[model samples]
Target: MTRVLVPLLRASCPPGAGGYGGSIELRLPDSEAERLGGVALVRAALRAAARELGWKAETFGWTGTIHGTMVGVTDRRTPPAPFDSVVDADRQRRMRDAVDRVGRPGTPSLPPTDEPSARLPTEEFLTAYAAAQGVVDR
Candidate 1:
């Protein structure tokens, strides 16, 4: 039987701050995202986060928009981010750069065994992002 891996991203940002959130669902089987690379997955996650944020704004009747910074990733079935908080401004640029640099095509290579696999480039970017976020280990 195929295992179901739910990869989620977490985020923290102020109004107008820009960034993406963690992905909690991979939506495999029928979802085309499964066929795409980690970069694509990240992109989709970002879009979803943005939409959700927008929804929240509408829900509260707030005219101000919000942005985000990924605090960490989660797998429900697996451990999620160890730390959770808002990413600073300087680190934000690095995060943006890392995501931008991960445009190369390929699926993220989950760590061997029950580990998560992200495309090589995407993996590298995430590592850098984690570091920038002051992550010492997974």
Candidate 2:
């Protein structure tokens, strides 16, 4: 698993008034993420993140979002998936292609495509998303 910290930014907020907020993303092999389920994955990620940062998980103050097999935790609010949030279409396509290429070293990597239908949000993502939204129990 890998931990990614993303600093929050808002145009309407003052430079220092946005609070100490950011997102933590836990990236793992696609198969493992699927095996764990959304709730379990988030819980595990939080514990791992807390340990890495030298903080107690209970006091970590995080909100989470799941995209496909990826889980992201935030200090203030859940962050959108990197592919979904990037403004530039080319960048988004590249991000999508990169994610698709993970763990398939021998296969020839496909070039980035602009087709919206190319986006693949897995069942794991939906379950995790629902859990994050409190629409389902953990």
Best by lDDT: 2
Off by over 4 Å in 2: 1-19, 26-30, 34-42, 47-67, 77-138
Query: Which ten-residue region of model 1 has the weakest summed lDDT?
Result: 55-64
TM per candidate: 0.20, 0.25
> Per-residue alpha-carbon lDDT of model 2 for 2-68, expressed as tens digits?
1422111121112233222323344445554565554465556555654554332342222333433
- Relative to the true structure, candidate 1 reaches a TM of 0.20
User: What's the residue-level lDDT of 29 in candidate 1?
Assistant: 22
Clashing pairs in 2: none
Each model's C-alpha lDDT?
0.33, 0.40
lDDT of 2: 0.40
34, model 1: CA deviation in Å?
A: 11
- Cα error, residue 111 of model 2, in Å, equals 15
The alpha-carbon lDDT assigned to residue 132 of candidate 1 equals 58
